[model samples]
Target: MTAFMEPFRIKSVEPIAFPTAAERRAALEAAGYNLFKIDADQITIDLLTDSGTGAMSAAQWSALLSGDESYAGARSFRRFESVVRDLTGFAEVLPVHQGRAAERLVLSALLKPGQASVSNTHFDTTRAHVELAGGKAVDLPAPDGGNIDLVRLRASFATEDVACVVLTVTNNGLGGKPVLMENIRATRAICDEFGVPLTLDAARFAENAYLITELEPEFTGHSPRKVAELMFRSADIIWASLKKDGIANIGGLVALNDPDLAARCRLELIAYEGFPTYGGLAGRDLDALAQGLLEVTEPSYLRYRAESARWFGEALRAVGMPVVEPVGLHAVYIDAGELLPGRNLPANALLAELYLEGGIRASELGTLAFGRVDPAGGPDIPSARELVRFCLPRRVYTRSHLEYVVEAAAAVVKRAEAIPGYRIVHQDPVMRHFTARLAPML
Candidate 1:
């Protein structure tokens, strides 16, 4: 393999903080041990999320100046729409502030009370939106990787009123694993058999396509853009958080073929978000997103993106940390269960330790993020996997920064047994992990 190098040069730089361990400890305590609550300035490396945290390119910055600020029928929106239509082959496109907003609009329109929206695995926000719309969220993740359990999926359609089947490419909820193209085709066939609309939660679509080219021999010569187009074509509806693959700071979209469903979503958009064209964002954001969509499909950038995460994952594994196999494109997930065996809330414990070790903040995708509290006063049910995700932002950070992270993680691993478990003291009814307060268990 060729040596890994960043595809783009650093045209600008942002200085990062190096808070003392004592200061980080204080910050962690003050924030109730939740990484999301910590301030950005207090963090040296913020791996809390990749959503909308990436740096934009020089071309994207230039596009921002060309934005038309019209309230309706904006030229910027038209350009953005055209780019999306060309890429995804969807006729009706509606812009939104972010991915979750798109989810709210689409799911609210399509889902009836007690209806189900099935997926390989629903990310936290997507699941929340489904339930908020008075629909049940059912996850049917394959035992391996990020594909739906085809046998179980077929069975689900036979028994439940499935509103839609959503396939999250490079499934975020399952350690950012790539979904196989063959799996997608088989899923499409099953959805067709059941007359269910197949939706692609394609936030990381480009990364998924790129990985497909690498992993699937039949798709060896396909460009990332072509692979992405094929993947999009398989879905009847698509929603994306441009924050990920769009390479933009803020934007999302819903694209579909159904006119009636689009109309329903448009009504919701006008009432809640801005006009259908602009949604809740300024015309400048639309323009920037248009350019970002074009740039993101470049093979060079995708290759670098995939390899960087893989490199980091391999490095972490070398240091006695068990990382999720087949390291994903956007993040490297550490198996917190293996790292801190028998410790309650092991992923949460590792999250705190990483912060104190190097002022590095990361998200816990294990029990805290996905576990469910027993309503009948029994023990909490843990997530299928106890993992901590180190989500790398696009066009930000370098190999040197990653090396520093590896070193910091190694320090924590050396004394992993010393880490303590935690108990949640306060949490919201839904998506509790975002704001949950926790205390270390003695």
Candidate 2:
């Protein structure tokens, strides 16, 4: 491979296919319905969780699993704190379990009835938590939902009920699109203007930082570390999933400048979770998280993941399948509309069909993206049945693995595209894609 070209290629490998439902059932039983079924020559490409396993050093693992919860547990806490400070340059850090846990805690501390949270964009969990707390989630008038709107956000801050502003890096709803840096700085100015705190939902922070500084070198003078610091500095509280940023199994951190708010979050942790020392994270997991955080900052590491997604996307596009243009590090979205007229199948059914094919996983925008939606009987938000998600877990699969997925997906889209009116069944009871029950016009 050339210096600029990655050695990875999905076409180089074979896709794993089960010959019968019984074998498929056993595979799901063993691995538990993860992306493991998407196999390569040697390993599976697991884009399911951002938490990268096997990244922790021996010393870090030893410290995390020691399990002696004293103020000296403060050392592990301090180690984590230093990591946050080194990467984000933030002054405070509070450990939490998973990304949504941090969101719930942060809002629990900050939200009140009638309070407003302004954001360039929001993940489903973030919006739900804010509304659950009786605070209104203002989607902050982005020029498009994919981009942030600072002028409208600043104006919203004029209200006394505005509690905080959130910015989700690499906006997940719009296929992981990111807000521009200038927009971020502008939002910071607006937050300052109204004295409202700006909190970053940094689940994808590592990837966003990498893209802004590296992939798009027009903004390269700033490293991921530098951009992270800039974003952190703008926030009163910054919270990110250790799963995504550190690449650990399940962990998150919430950092804030206010001592009072931090204390309040800790109190909630006591009631809901157990204690601050071990917030649903194994000590070994924390060590892994610490190690993963360091790995994500490397240019080569980010480039590897970015290139893999690009490679798969290219193959799909070459086959005439519509996909979200490559933007971030993780998943590639297969736009269903290109195959079916006006997304005729609906996301719910599309996800089901993809799973029934040799492939065992996927998602849709209208229903599965948020996982929760309360439709108003009146005029509705654009019911976009966007694309089927193919999330790639970091460091798990390789070139050959990527090819297998591309090949299988290409075949599936080709076959499924010909079928008409296959019903989308919502087994999860939460996010339903397309139901044969809903009229085609709906």
Candidate 3:
């Protein structure tokens, strides 16, 4: 494998706190053993999330200076619009504060009561938003990879009132695996056969495109931008959290060709988010997002971004950790269930242990995140897999920082058998992992 270096140099820096072991223990207890509740000041190397935690480029900073701060019809919005339209080929582009807001706008407008929104795997927020709109969220993951089960998807239209089909490129909920281009084409064909609209949850579109150039022979030698355009061509709608691939600290967008649907979503946007142009974001944020969109598709940057995550995953797997195979661009997922066999709340247990081993905070993406509670007091349904995600923020953290993570993980593995399990003592009805309180099952 060829060694890839960071394509750009760091021009700014922030100090990280190195809390002592006792301080970490105190912080963990205070946070109720929830990594999300832990303060950033207590974390030495925060891998909790890749969302809105990236480092911006000098160009993005320069773009910020030129932002036209008008309440309506700002030049910043125009710049953002042009870039999105050029990339997505969508006539109607609606900006929002973030991806969930965009998901809320689109799902609210499209889903009727008792309808279903289907996907390969719906991320936590997307699933919640669907239910909030009085619709059901259905997932039909492929047996081998991140592709939607095409047979089940086609059959779903026959049996269920599917409002829309969402295809999350580089499926985040299922180990961040990239969906094959052929799968996208097949799904589009199926959607056309049933006359149902298809939406691409394109948060990591650039990373997915870069992987296509590497993995698919048909896309071999193609530029990431061209591959991205090809991927966008298959979708009737596209919504993205720009914080991931856009390399900006904040921003998101919803783009589609349907005029009536766009009009309906804009109404919701006005009622909830903001005006059509600004959409709950400042002019400076729009400008930064515009610049970041352009920068994200560069081949060198995408190469480094994908390879660094792969490097980290491979390193951990070499040390007896069961990492999710074929690491995705933004994160490396570990199979916590396998790591701590027969242990209750294995993912949550590993999460607490990681923080204690080193001030390294990561997110659990398994039972606590996706499992359902039995209202009748029966056994709680568990998620398909118990996973802990070490999400890498864009253009942040050096290789040395990752090395420290490896060392910490190695330590955990050395004493894996002694790591205690946990049980949730309190949790919210929806998205419980964010604020759930847990205790050790010693």
Clashing residue pairs in candidate 1 (N, C-alpha, C atoms within 3 angstroms): none
lDDT tens string, model 2, 1-442?
Answer: 6444443333333354444555544444343232233342212333333444323334445556754444336455656667777877766566777888899999978899999887876766787788889888877546444457866766675564799888888777667766666667777777787787878888777678777785455577766766767767766788877776676667898887788888888888777865676676655555556666776776766777787777777887786677777545677777665566544445544544444454445545554444333465442334444556666765556567667666666676777645443322223332233221332223
Q: For candidate 1, lDDT tens digit of each residue in 343-382?
A: 9899999999999999998899898888888989898899
lDDT of each: 0.92, 0.64, 0.92
TM-score of 2: 0.81
Q: What is the alpha-carbon lDDT for the whole of candidate 3?
A: 0.92
Candidate 2: clashing residue pairs, number: 12
What TM-score do all the candidates reach, one by one? 0.99, 0.81, 0.99
| lDDT for 1 (candidate 1) | 68
Residue 189, candidate 2: alpha-carbon lDDT: 77
